[model samples]
Structures are given as structure tokens and as C-alpha cells.
Target chain A: MARRSSLASRIFPFVFGLVVGAGVLYFFLPGPPQGGKVQTAQQPGAKPQPGQQGPAQPAGSTLAEVRARGYIQCGVSTGLPGFSNPDDKGNWTGIDVDFCRAVAAAVFGDASKVKYRPLNAKDRFTALQSGEVDLLSRNTTWTMSRDTSLGFDFAGVIYYDGQGFLVKKASGITSAAQLNGATICTQTGTTTELNLADYFRGQNMSYKVLPFEKNEEALSAYDNGRCDAYTTDASGLHAQRLILKTPDDHIVLPEVISKEPLGPLVRQGDPQWEDIVRWTLFALIDAEELGVTSANVDQQMTSASPEVRRLLGTEGKFGEPLGLSNGWAADALRAVGNYGEMFERNVGTKTPLGIPRGLNALWRNGGVMYAPPIR
Target chain B: MRWSWTDPRMRALVWQVAALAATLVTLWYFAAMAHQNLARQHIATGFGFLDNTAGFGVVQTLIPYSEESSYGRAFLVGLCNTLLVAALGTVFAVMLGFVVGVARLSTNWLIARLATVYVETLRNIPLLLQLFFWYFAILQPLPGPRDSLTLLPGIFLSNRGIVMPAVETTPSTAAFVLCLLTAIAAAIFIGRWAKARKLRTGESFPTLIVNAVIIIGLPGLVWLIASAAFALAPPVMGKFNFEGGWRVLPEFLALLLGLTLYTAAFIAEIVRAGIQSVGRGQTEAAHALGLSSGQTLRLVTVPQALRVIVPPLTSQILNLIKNSSLAVAIGYPDLVSVFAGTVLNQTGQAIEVIAITMAVYLIISLAISFAMNLYNARVAIVGR
Candidate 1:
């Protein structure tokens, strides 16, 4: 009995020590409660006191925080050919990438002052809202719920996209309506899933949704005939079709179901920062409309047009209103030429994506990319 | 007055108190921190979201569910999937483990070598790699439904899923249940009779043969009667899938196959160790008593070996349960995938989602440990 008592006594402290250690570890471990709320309160649209000069910082103040950090943390996709993929030389290019450069140029006057963080569709919002990225310029669609509920502000639409269905030509399916009772492959954690459901339900047609966790898996399943059709953003369908064993084997259906406004996003609250980002994009569009390509931007900066002079920082103090340097817009324009230049250089017919500028053209060309006057 | 610090009882009490205090303090700190942080982030810290609509659909739910269901329902679906995979994996692993364990001790050189090779090769590779190989290399290569690989009549294997003819029972399933109960009762009666006859007459009866006959024959008889009483429904092949058959999704098959093969290797090692732990003296004593090889193993070796096996085997079972979380990697919609990934995204409540997920896993682990301990106590040695 004495020995047993002794053994128990000896074992007691050891057990106690383990419990204490686990408790301490748990205490130190990072959890959502501690940091998440504070960050949300700091978001752009977060309420500020009367004396407070500007909007609250979202979780991470993307604008001021990026400046303090000395490098713009830009979120890009892992690899989407002709979008945000890495080049043969290990440099990131494409339209989505140039937007990141444009943001960097506006902030630091050097487009190269950026650190790209690759994220998946599911993780992109969290990365931005968590302040891991200064800007999210991935091929993400802008929607109402994402805008209000997710606590992020979207800069204007850069690409006008629509959802489309792709099926094998051999299946003799010409339209999406013909796909009743079909098995459709779609990627989970995106608007595509809801779009597919709404479209089918709206048409009073029944179909089976075979959702895959990744786009590649969905594509592979569709290619292997596991599903009768694949649905995604029309642009993504075109990009993925290029990699198929037989590029011509599948045909994208003509029916476009939903409007997908793709653009860059920043966490909400910092109105000053939001304006800076919004105007940077507009500057690119306005530059292209005024025929101010990167090669001629230097020359146009000295020209007499009051709108150009104001935009080029030769006439007004628009930059001061946003608390930026006078030449910020000019810096952004010089970084990636303009919106039209970015499109032609990245996903144009000259490139692999070969996307045409349909609804993405300037207002002068009868498209919807109209920017407010610089004055 | 003469008590020293080395006194056992004193030491044990001191240790317990110290441990208790430390645990309390640590819990207090984390609770404080979590409260503070959640308050700061404007994130709600509660399980209220469980009442909110899930707004997403699960691919393979055993229960009927829809997008309009609550988050609580989604959690149930995910938990069901996890249990489904773990149960199926455990069943297959035990059968394969026993075969391999026996083969490792086989007299035939080729069989022994083959089993040894399988154990070594599978044991070394990571489970994630095995999962990928099965999902990508094996399942993805299967032909589509238009040209499915038919294994047998009413059974087909394709890239989509494994389809088999299911026994479609109606309200008359009660008849089948009665048949099953009759077989079990017959088997028990035969076993008891065999035991009584052996004890009274000092003569053994073939209990195994009698039990088998009662179980199988009674079940067969009842099945016939049940079928006659009720119309038997047959499976028919439908477009894309079998209409009246049970279908196992490709994700489930991959996860189940991967987990079973991966865990069986570890189980084989455990079984080998247990058998080796039995003393040679016991076997020699059995031989001296003129006991046959099978009798020595069944009567002498196994009983001793089990004592050595049960404790470690308990831990391995717990490990298998915990490792089932890896189902997320292959998109099997286990607790983590559905609750943490999908629900978190839909709700925008990361803190609530993560906390719930952690709590669920802890509860599962604790339940397994409790069950294992109860079994352990029953099998433990009693002392005077």
C-alpha cells in the first residue's frame, strides 16, 4: 500500500505538468476570435468618430499598411494560362498581374515593388480580409453578397465575363437546353455551382451536379466523359479548352447564363485608399481613351488638354484630395500602359487566351468602360 | 513531523494539485484571449449559426438533405460521411490484416515473401500519396458509363462510381428481420447445447459445425419464407446509374481503399508483435501435453498474446479514427471539409466554424478512448 501510494504520488505531478503545458500552448495558439474582430472593426467602412479624419482600416489597412510595409502584397492565382500564370522566366504576367503592377506603381511609383501571393478561389477573400494581401487582382467575380457580407470593396470591373457550358461535339448537344437529364461537372466553392443550379431550375430541367473540389479535377472528369457537360466562366472554359488532348474535341455552348464582373478587390473601410485604387484603374482606361499609351504618356504629360493635364498631374491637385503624390496617376499609367494595352498584351488574339475586347472596350468604342472626368 | 518531500502520498497530492492549478490557469488565459480577440474582430462567438441555412448541397448524403437545410444538418451529413469511411475502412482493414498476418507466418516461402513485401512497401509511403495514386491513377482510368467495365451481372465499375444490385425491401423488411433474429437464436441455442453436453458427459461435441449449420441453415430457411411472403424487388440499370442498387461514390471508394491498405500494414506489425510476445515455454508445455498445433494456438498461445495485444491495438484503433480526418485531402466531405471549408465560406464566421470543428474532433477522440478503456478493463488480469 505504501509503494502504491508512493507511485501515485510520483505520477501526480507529471500528469499535472502535461495538463499545464497543454493549457499554456492553447493559450498562445492563434485563433480567430482575438484578431478577426479587431481587423473587421478597422475595415474601410468601419464607423469612425467625428474627429477621425478618414475611413477605418479594414482588418489590415491595405493602402497605409502597404506603404508602411514598403511592398505591395498582391494576390494572384496559382496558374491560369494568359491570366496570372508565371512565365518561362519565372516572372508573372497577364492582365490580372498588370493590375497588381498598376496598384504598386500608384503607391510606390515603381511597378516592381510588389510581392505576389498566389491563392485559390476559396482562400482569396480570406487572404485579402486578413490583410495578407494588399490587393486581390485574381480572376474573381464581383457579386452583391461578396461585396456587402464579405467586407471587401471591389474596384470597378476589369473584365466582363459570363458563365457558359462546354460539351463534346460528338455528343451532338448544341445548346444548354439540350442538356436536360445530363451530368454536369463543376468546381465547388464558386458562383458557378449556384449559376448551374439556378439555370437548370429556371429552365424547368433536371440535371445532376458532379462537383469537384478543384477546376482541374472537374475538367479531367469532363474530359474523361465522367460528366456530360462542364460549366465555368466562359473565359476559363476557353483557357482550359486549350490544354485538352484534342482542343477541337469539345465545343463551348453559345448560351451565356450569368454576368460575371471580374476585377480587383480590397478590404472595406478605407475610402481614401479605395478611391486611390478606383482612380488608378480609371486612369488606365482614360489614358487608353485619350490615346495615351505608355510610350506616349511622357509626351502627353506636357500637352495642353486640361483633362489630360489634370490626369497627368500638370493641372490640378486631385492626388492631394486622396493624400497621394501629384504624379500618382501618371505613375500608374506608365506602369502598364492602359486598360486596352493590358488586354491586348495579355489575353488578346496575339496571346494564347485570345479573348476579344467585347464589353470591355472604352465608352467611345460603344462599350461600357466609361470613366468619370479627371477634374 | 518526519515526513519528507520524497514521501509518495505527499508527492502525488502535490502533483495533482499543481496539475489542476496549471490546467485552470491555462484555460482561463485562452478563454480570456479568445474573448478579447473575437470582441476586437467583430466576430460573433457562439453556436447560433447552427440554425442558419447551409445553402450548399453535399454530393453523397445518406440522409435526405437540401441547400435550404440548416448548418446543423450539413454537419450531420459530414459526420455521417466520416463514420461511413471509417467503418468501411476498419472492416476491410481487419480482414486484410488477418490474412496478411497469417501469411507472414505461412510455411510456404512465396506467400510469406509476398506478404512481407506488401507490408514493407505500403508501410513506408505516406497515406496522402497512396490516396492520390488510387484516386488519380486507378479510379480516373476507369471507362465512363457508356462503356463501363462490368465485373459481374448487375455490377459495374466506372470512373463515376461502383454500382451493385441492392436488396430493395419494403415494409415487409420486417419479415427479413424476423429471419435474421431466428438464425441468431438458433446459433445461440446450438452453442449452449454443445457446451452442456460436453460438460455433463465429459465428451466434446463439434460445436463449430453445429453452430455453423444452425446459423446458415436457419437463415436460408427464413430467407425463403420471407421471399415467399413478400415480393422481391430486383435492381435495374438506369441512365447514368443503377436505379434500384446501392452506389458507392468514387471519392468514398478511394478514401476507404487508401485508409484500409495504409492502416492494415500497421495492424500487421502489431499482430506480429503480439504473437511474438507469447513465451516459448507455454508452447512447449502445450506440446508436452500432446496438444495439436491448432489446439495449442487456440487454447494456450492466443489467450496470453491477447493481453499483450489489447493495449497497443486500442491505441491503433484510436489512431485510425483520428486519421480519418485525412478524408479532406481527397474531397470526401468529412467533418473538416464540409464544416470547416464549405460552411465557413458560406457563413463568413471563421471563428465559430473552427471552434466547432475542433470541439467535434475532441469529442470523437474522447468517445473512442472511453470505449477502449472500458474494453481494456474487462480483459485486464484480476489479482488476489
Candidate 2:
């Protein structure tokens, strides 16, 4: 026993001493210059020198990179009907995917010059920031913290949304306040979860939250009576409600707890790339305002009107500064129709979602959506 | 080089030193690379996120938790939930395993066949599928809270959870707990005393009776004394669901049920192998000493079987603990689901979160092995 204990005693100190010594070495040894400055706030366009032997990835050069690679890497949602969903043949469509295709057309003059990567809410920010995707066209909610802190810049609002609750009509939960002590289900790792807590806590009510990694799982749980209510974007509730057994049996609550301006995003450092995407979104909306339908875009290209000619790339060199051909906007408009066309094709009153264009209509049509003109 | 290689001890030492150096350099390089990448991407790396408000709620929590609580508290809640599942799973698995293991060796043809079928069926099916079956198939199809299946007067099962009556708080709860601890201490002392007396006199003392009286009778007495303040709280139905009772959420039930059923199969095999390992002559020797079949199996077979049984049992326990992390699939708020999934996503601190999570499992596995080793040493024949 004495000998065994002595051996244990010796072994323990040696192992512990090695650990202590290694820990000390780790702390004292100087690392790279950029590693220590862990800034709480992000500064866009800030570039630390690249490694000695590593390949150069200059900040804000996404356009050149995409051109060099011969395809744009666009991050989209895993599946959200009318926003980003793959059809039976694995062909991706919806407003978000349309924008990705539009960006591809602008860059390569071919709508198919893009590879789609499906991202969940948690992975979208990292995927964009890590240069895994050239642009993020997922239905990501644009927020101040995500824009500044996470090094992402919102290009433009593709869909305006707000947090709302979906409950069975049989339960008669009219307002958000009536959901006190009710269990809510939502997709985990999103701003929607935080909004759920804030809304409940702000009202001095307690609610059990059941979070699922996948939105479909959460919706399934809500359907199976695992939760009393499902909370997410108002638009999402409308879309998800269609999949329920009796869509008419559930009601979207009146309260809009938080604003969720759903938009495409890009890494913050790339001003040129950000402009290209921002303009692509605006081009769609502007095309709608200019009455440039996909059917009439070819004919309009021959029109004598200067603004119409400029927009269709018949008069000016507008796309040159954005590092593209003048026909880029025309290609984008042709690829996915205009913004109105994109909206009408997927999520408008005609679609299964049957959602009326409430806040998503153009400003000229008495709605908040207004985009800058292509000069 | 040949001369140095001829000395095995020296060669081993040199190789070990070289491997250690290589490991250290690789780790250092990776750390440097990670630091550079994080910096280049402008992602902060630190444990500061632990202090940030979790800003979310969980379906079930043992300890007091709120959206206002820090991420650290959420981590603690997740850890507690994990331990709760693992500890309960271990106990149930071992109990069911011992029964099944013994049944596999039963002389009755039907009983042995049934046990064999059970072991074979569960051992072959994947655990994740079983967890899904329990969660999505079985529990989900149950009635809603309003139409819960009432098993008894105060016991109900719904999709939300199994609700049952429980003892409400007592004003003298601490005092009662204290008396219970003292009773356990007294029982241990009495057992030792009896053991010593039997060694000296060769007349066995009834330690079991003394232990039962001390352990149960004392606790029962305390409960009786405190019965005035203690109350049973039955679940009260409300507008939408039940109001007050001890609630076990379906996620917890599914995870626990799945883990126990899956792990018990392997543990049963281990137990069977252990029992068979004990020599037939040992049982014969016990019978020759006028011991009954039951007594021979108990006094001679089990004690010896335990020596062989414990090591493999420890591995099974560790597997159960690790498998409990699959709770994420069924939305059980275990450590992986809450801390690693939600917390990691929210804070975007993958390195720190994953490292801590890996360390937690490592430490838990090591500790279980340590405890089992101690028990194994005690059960091993002395001076062999």
C-alpha cells in the first residue's frame, strides 16, 4: 500500500506540474499581433495583414473572387416556402432564391451561374463572415447588432415581418396577453426566440418555451400538442399555417411584438459587393415601378425614353462602376421578373400562402417599400 | 542507433518524449491558427458570454431559471438536467438489467426465452430511432392536456408530461432531512459493529434488521413528526391545462425511457457474462456447506460475479451518460441542447463552448471509472 501510494503521489505531481507549466507557457508566450485585440464593436473594411505564406483574401473583393471562381456562392435558407424552398426536382425558388439568381445573372449574365448553400438561422452569419458564401439571401431579419457587431450589412429588405403568435382557434387565444403560462414553440438560435422571451417577460407573464433546431420540428411539436402556441415571424406563421391539418382552425394573433425586416445580407467589408446586391434588389423594385415586366423587358430595351433606356442598359454605362455590363440590371430583371413579379409568383394573394401585399407593396402603391432609382 | 534501440526502456522513454513534443507543437500551431482566424474575422474569443443574459426560456428546468438569468445559469440548468437523466437512467438500467440477466439464466423455458428475445430486440435497434419512437410516435399521439389519460386519482399522462401528486413544502423539511442523514450514519456504524462482532464470535448478527430499523424507521418517525406541516398537492386542472403538480415533461420521459431501455440490454449481457464466469465448483461448495440454491447463488455467486461484472458495467454507464446528449434530437434540454446548441449559436463562441462541453463528458467518464475501480478493488479477493 505504501509503495503504491508513493507511486501515485509521484505521478500526480508530475502530471499536475506539467499542466501548470504548460498553462504558464501558454499565457506568457506572445501570440500574433491581431489575436489579442478582441474588439467588442466591429469596424468594417478593417484588414489585418494576411499571413506570410497564406493566399491573399483582400477585404471587399467578393466580386473579383466570384468572377475568378466563375460562380457566385449564395447562402439561402434550408427551406421556407415563398422565401426559399427547393421544389420536388431540387430546383430552388422563392423571393430569396430569386435574388440569388438575380445576383448570379448580374455577375455572369447567366442565371445558372450560382451554387446554392442552405443555411439555418444559426449558421447564416458565420457562413457569410467566414467567406463560405459570397452573399446571404436567406430570410434573415436585419437588426442593428447583426449589422454592426457580427460584421454583416443588410442589403435591402426583401420582406417586412413582425413577431406574432399562432394558436388554435378552438383555444380562443385572441391577444398575446392571453398566452400567459402557455407553452410556445419556435425555431431555436434566432432573434425570434429572444423576442418571444422579451415579449413574455415584458408583460410579466410566464411561458414555457420549447425550441427546436429545425422550424419544421417546432411546427410539428405545436401540431402534436407539445406546445400551446407557435411563435415566429408573422409571415412565417401565415406560410406555416397552410401546412397544418386545418389551416382555418388556427388564427394569427393581432399583436406584432417586434419588427422583423427580412432581408438579404453580405459581409460588411465589401462595399462594392454590397452595392451590387443592394442595387440588384432595388433594380427589381424599380423595374416594377417602371412597368418593366419580364415579358416587356426585351421590347422596353428598344424604347426611346431615356430613363427606360438607361435602366435596360440601352443608354448608359451604369453597371460599369459596379463592375458589370450595362445589361446586368436587364439580365436580373429577366431572370426573376421584377420585384413585384417575384412577390406575386411566390407569396402573393394568388399563391397558396394567399397573403395580401400589406406592407410589402411599393411606395407608389401606398406601401412602405421604396427603392432607389437606377440612375 | 542499434545500441540505443536494444534498450527497450530507454527506447520507450525516447519515443514517448518525441510523441509528447509532437503533440504539444501540433496543439500550439492549431491554437495559433485559430487565434489568427478569429482575429482576421473580427470574432471575439472569450468566456464573457457566460455572464450574458440567456434571454430565452426552456420547457423544463429543475432549478430556478428565468429569461433574465445569465448564460452561466442556463449552463448549470443544462448540467443538472443531464445529471438528472444520467443518474436516473443508471439506476433504472442497472435494476432492470440485473433482473433480465438473471432471467436469461432461469430454468423456466418461457422466462429464459422471453429474456433472450428482449435482449436481442433492443440491442439490435439503434438508440436514436428508439428515442424518436418514444417521443414522436408514442408520447406525441397521446391526448392533449385537457384530455389527459388519468392513470389514477392523482396521476395523469398527457403529451405535455406525466403529472402526479407530490409532497408540498414543509416548514421543518430541513430538520427532517437532517434526522434522515443521522439515521443513515447510525446504520453504517451499526453495520460495521455487527461485522466486527461476527468476525470475533462466529455468530452472525442480524445487521439487515438493524439497518432497516435505523434507515427506514428513523426517517419514517421524522416524517410522522413533521406530517402536520407536510401536505400532498394534487394536480389541479385549469382553463387550458393542469395548474400545479410535479410535472415530468415528455422530452425528459422520452430521453430517460429511451436511454434506460437501450442501455439495459447491454448491461444485461454484461451481467450474464459476469454470472457465468463464476466457477460451478464455487456454487457446489456452497451447496455442500448446507446452503440452499438461492443462498449459494446469493452468497457465493453474486459476490464473485460482481468482481467480473463491475468493469464492463462502468463502460455501459459511461455510454448511457454520453447517449443522454441525444436528448437534443427530442428537444430535451440537456447540456448539449441548451448550452452547446442554443448558447453556442447565440454567443457564436464555438471554441470555448465545444471545449467546455468535451471536458465535461471527459471528466464525468473518468469519475465514473474511478468510482467503479474503487468498488471493483473492494470486491476483488484479497491476498490472491
Best by TM-score: 2
Candidate 2, overall lDDT? 0.84
Q: Considering only chain B, report the TM-score of each candidate against the true chain B.
A: 0.87, 0.88
Q: Which docking class does model 1 fall in?
A: acceptable
B183-211: candidate 1 lDDT, tens digit per residue: 78878888888789888988887878877
Candidate 2 has which clashing residue pairs, if any? none
Runs off by more than 4 Å, candidate 1: A1-46, A49-61, B1-45, B170-172, B202-244
TM-score to native of every candidate shown: 0.88, 0.89
Misplaced by over 4 Å in model 2 are A1-56, B1-15, B172-229, B380-384
- Quote the lDDT for B121 in model 1: 95
Evaluate residue A176 in candidate 2 and report its C-alpha lDDT on the 0 to 100 scale.
86
